[model samples]
Target chain A: MSAATTMVGRSIRLSRRNLDTAIMAVVLPVLMMALFVYVFGGAISSVQSYVDYVVPGIVVLCTGYGATSTAMPVADDMKKGVVDRFRSMPISGFSVLTGHVVASVARNALATFAVVLVALLMGFRPTASVGAWALAMGLLLVYVLALSWLAAGFGVIARSVESASLLGFFMLFLPYLSSAFVPVATMPPWLRAVSEHQPITPVIETVRALLTDQPVTSGRPALAWSGGLLVVAFTWATWLFRRISSR
Target chain B: MIVETEGLTKRYGTRTVLNGLDLEVAEGSVLALLGPNGAGKTTTIRVLSTLTRPDGGSARVCGFDVVRQAADVRGVISLTGQYAAVDEEQTGRENLVMIARLHRRTRPAARARASELLERFGLVDAADRRVRTYSGGMRRRLDLAMSLVARPRLLFLDEPTTGLDPVSRTTTWDAIGDLVRDGVTIFLTTQYLEEADRLADRIVVLHNGGVVADGTADALKNSVGGTRLDLTFASREEALRARSAVGGLADGPTLGLPSDGSAAHLHRVLDDLLAARIHVLRVATHRPTLDDVFTTLTAVAA
Candidate 1:
């Protein structure tokens, strides 16, 4: 294989290196969707398909939570002195980090598919055509890319595994507090204002609008916020990565 | 010379680990760096291997500047440490093949190189087993084998046998000896002075971030002082008398006299002992060991 292909292959291999951990990573979102949509579905919504409201949100949650596995393993790699070995090797520096982030996103995508399949079986339907669904997929992926970078920064900055894992857990909480579950309109006035403007709400609303074909009142705002947040996250992550690496 | 470090200085905040260290390792030869703990051995390795850049000064490996031409330096050298780096999750064969593949070896060539390294390191049988299952020695061997996958001309070994038992140490020594015999110039950092004595054509003693002394093993031992001839008599009186006659130091039943461990010194000592009629029950010569060289060199620096 070519050099770039081999590097990509190594990244893929490293990402799939752990099976149990990957499964554990996805389990939280799967279980959260199942419990909230089935158990708490009756109390919260007037919408016919509770599964539809929850899966996309839960997938976003999965992307954020699954980020921990990526962070901790990289932290573990540094802690175990595995990175010292890599530093001496002829391998590219960015390849391992790229491999790590890409592999994690791949696993997150799989979990998203699983959550989507379960939602579909429970009557979750996207009113968007194949192309729109593709575009929505593109949007979720961009979201995952943003989150992957944030976790990458966490992996670099964290001095311990627990601290690294906390970065992802901390990010997951933002989605729950945003307009992911109940609408921002139902929240207390102060939280409602923050939730409406928060980054997660826009991405979630965009995916929701794409899936349900509702009149997206905040459509222009959602596009700007989602795309802007991705750029900001990427910029911060790269800056963080460079700082940690230099040290 | 393939590798040269000119005044490589590394400081971590307030303390300097490597202080303006200058050294040169010739091509197709070995230069063993000997020092105690925290003597900046690993720091030097990190700088030369392109792991961590030095705070000051420069190092060239494989004749390429470690900073500006780091890619060229990286292209020609490999480093292994006290711990074997074979991924415990991957099999021994897989680890070697993975490294080989990383060097852009084709599938068949990678497999072939992995097998060859396994055979050379006496790890062919356990090649399929995950490295976690291997013994400490087995794992270290596999790590060394993986390093040789590219047949790097310059190899950096940092305390490569620190935790190994005697048998394992000997096994690693033999492997290193084989590599040296193959004309691979090895730049090794070791705590074992004896290891340096055995393997290094020239040994440089590092202490407090700089060279304390650098010479061949025997040359270093010679620089410390002449050998001492210690003789023990049954009584303090005889020891005293022998001490006066030979101009030796008498403490208890022992007499310590300097000798060059040559026939002329022995003959002169024997004549004096006979002249004094001192009945010496036991006689022994204390040649300066590598330990003596280490202690003296580091002690003076300290």
Candidate 2:
């Protein structure tokens, strides 16, 4: 437990020092939200107000960007031989992976908060009660945690930092295909199926419903997907860490 | 023994890195695993330090099995790999404190230990600077300082001075010498014969993943035939003629003859070469060093 806390502190410090990535995590999603609500929102006729609709998607997209950034640092530690140093000590691989995952969750929280603040300044309003807001944030936390662990697993397997950044590209692209920026009904039949059936779509829909104080239809699937992904990703990351570090 | 390995073997996709190797190191001694690239020096250190597992046989460190009791092994050992493992984003003090904390030191205690190590390694000036701003030698010193934060009973250094400049190398050597004085068991690997001779009480020559020679530096050197006279000739033909006339070993343009380090023996060899009409360009008596032992042992094994 001490080792885990120490690693977490170290990882947070690393994240703080990495100014470029931190800025990108917060700024990119805000810019994307502005682009969607002002530029693309006028053409879409399915939603009443695009800012309120696009804000939830931007929140999910922010988490995706933040979670995928976890992979690069994890890959750096692995390639730089620090993981070997840690493994040779009494430290467990669980602690090391936990450090990165927790830091990822923290970064996502901050970026999500920034995106929400920008949405409010741009004429977006959420009509949720306090409890609903808490529940929505809690679900977003689970999603971020799951994706971060998944990224850490990729980091362990990636041979270099450049390859690890590819995970970020995939995560950033997933939100566009989901219900983040546009309504699923507005898409082609095949893309609509993809947007409705994928994990990100359900997560975004759940958050949107909770914030808008509307009927929550996707809550169960959102929790199920996030919970299932958390289990698999945590198991996979720790297993890969143990195997690679020991070898 | 602080470290004991019997017939240890490791194969990487059919290429054996450690092939039926055997080794032992007594407590409070410096043992250097001397070998060239692909001789498995790093593998041996990795196996003993619990970073790697051997395929066959077994290894025991500080009375715990390397595979089964790996956690215990880790508890008593620290490894400094070929590369400096310090985090570039963190400051030097932070890196050291992190390691100390991982070793279960209290917050204040970890801080104190980090300060002490930074001062000892002459890194106090750069203690709060990020490792990314450090020079090569400073980073290496910080890497060593981090490894010593826990003060383990045993330390494994795999090519500790491989890429350092000459001054940094000597400073590292001095730091290692200080550790030896503190009675820590050190198992270091190096390709430089001088490093093995200077810091190791016992030098083990590894070839083809096996121990080819293991003894004190002097013992290994004596094993390669001691106190030879190096007779350099102006031409390879003259060296060959001197070798045939005086019954010595011919290498390039030099003939090496075993000598007793006496004036009479030198005179006799020069007389024999002179009578044989072999023109000698240089005459120097060479003492056997670890280089001779390493080359001779590895050459024979090859």
Candidate 3:
């Protein structure tokens, strides 16, 4: 009955309501994985036999790609003056952001699950134990959280809904050029260094390494980078959220 | 008075939005903030609602400081903004229930309240419909209903009837009147002078971020300085004769006399006219409206 509990419950309900789009987001990765594995698996160094290698990458990219739809909801809220309504309510200060972040993450999780099922159909399997799978899922969820916040920042700062979508697109494109799909050595020299050293590269490497029974190079480096990225992204997001919410 | 603010100033960079404003509203009285667009009306509402911090000055709602005691301030106040907050994607019923639940109403009570507000707002017919399907007027009514879910003691309405048709506006005005009757202290910002005249117990005129004028509606109308009596006659000669006898201004068949817009003043003129047997076909008093007060203040600032 207290205000705090009310906020959480309301936020959770809001999240559940919007999660209908979640199934749509998941459909994208599922379709792509199915087509790429069944139709084109024989050509151009097939990811089919080792589809597990690319599943994590596709899941992450798919999540980011679908985030373009997110900016509109936020931007629409702003344009229609719903943010002003939220500001005036006795709702919790952090609950709005919590609702948004959790909703986006939940959507991405559904999409990630679709890709995992597709990978399994293509004879792919995660070599890690259930415990490691849970850890990997945890990392994926955290990554989505930070990325969704970044998307939310763009939503607030963008002058228009179109511009907001552009920002979301730019986020997706940058990671594709990283070591998300292919090894760094496959790229030209300068891009290779950039791709290998990119923040998402270590994360992709850690997930890819886990799924394929690869040694993972101790994974200490990936953990440090992911942790630092989360802190910085969350800090920037919190600052943006506070500024935007107050305004 | 349950609410008072003095020397409240707010600035966005070099542009001052609210300048050293002062206000007082008696408990259970509806105080309407009247101003044109960009007149610091909404900004003032924001500051009091704890959505934005003022640059300087102090605001107290029910004896709670808005800045230092925001949490307590928030407990007593609620705002229904210029537009609706019901998500277009959500059903009208869901929207109302969500807000009620968020205000800590128990599940059964929240559902009951939501259904009550829906019926009261005349939204029961479309309660199952998504808000996007509702008309602008309906959505606005729903928004107002949602803010009332918690029964806040102090409610803020920022141009609550903007973009509504006359009928809708009148309906909204009636709803507001009912709230005042229930002992709610309402703070409203409106561009329509008629709204202020019709609903507000007191009016505050803000210009250039300061309180240019503040008083009851009658007092503010009086602030325009003089009331005019217009008398129209059948002939210009009659008008001229009336102007001469009354020592008033004449144009065509109309003669104007200055008065205080008081019935006693009208009685004196009527008695004098009857005693003199002055022939006049029509006589009407013209006092300044809040529109005039707004224009006068804005022009002075400019």
Model 1 ranges with Cα > 4 A deviation? A1-4, A14-17, A217-247, B228-285
Predicted candidate 1 versus true structure: per-residue lDDT over B67-153, tens digit per residue: 898778878898896666667777899888878888889899999999999999999899998777999889889888888999989
- Compared with the true structure, what per-residue lDDT tens digits does model 3 show for residues B1-302? 67889999999989999888888888898889988788899889988998888899999988989889888887888888877667787788988877777777778998999999898888999999888789888888888888888888999999999999888888888888888888889999998899999999888887777777888899987777577777888889878877566656677998766667788977887677666677778989787666667766666777
Better of 2 and 3 by TM-score: 2
TM-scores of all candidate predictions against the true structure = 0.86, 0.92, 0.85
Candidate achieving the largest lDDT: 2
- What value of lDDT does candidate 2 attain over all alpha carbons? 0.89
**Which pairs clash (backbone N, Cα, C closer than 3 Å) in model 1?**
none
Q: In Å, what is the interface RMSD of model 2?
A: 1.0
**Relative to the unseen true structure, what is the C-alpha lDDT of residue B133 in candidate 2, on a scale of 0 to 100?**
98
Displacement of the residue A197 alpha carbon in candidate 1, Å:
1.8
Candidate achieving the largest DockQ: 2
Ranking by lDDT: 2, 1, 3
Residue-by-residue lDDT tens digits, candidate 1, A1-247: 2444554565566556667766676676678887888888878875547776776778777776775467776676666656666656666654556666777777888888888877777777767777667867887777777677667767777899888888776776888788677777788998888888887787788778777777556656766765676688667766765455544
- By DockQ, is 1 or 2 better? 2
Candidate 2 Cα misplacement greater than 4 A, ranges:
B228-280
**Native-contact fraction for each model?**
0.40, 0.93, 0.61
Model 1, position B253, has a per-residue lDDT of: 90
Docking class of 2: medium
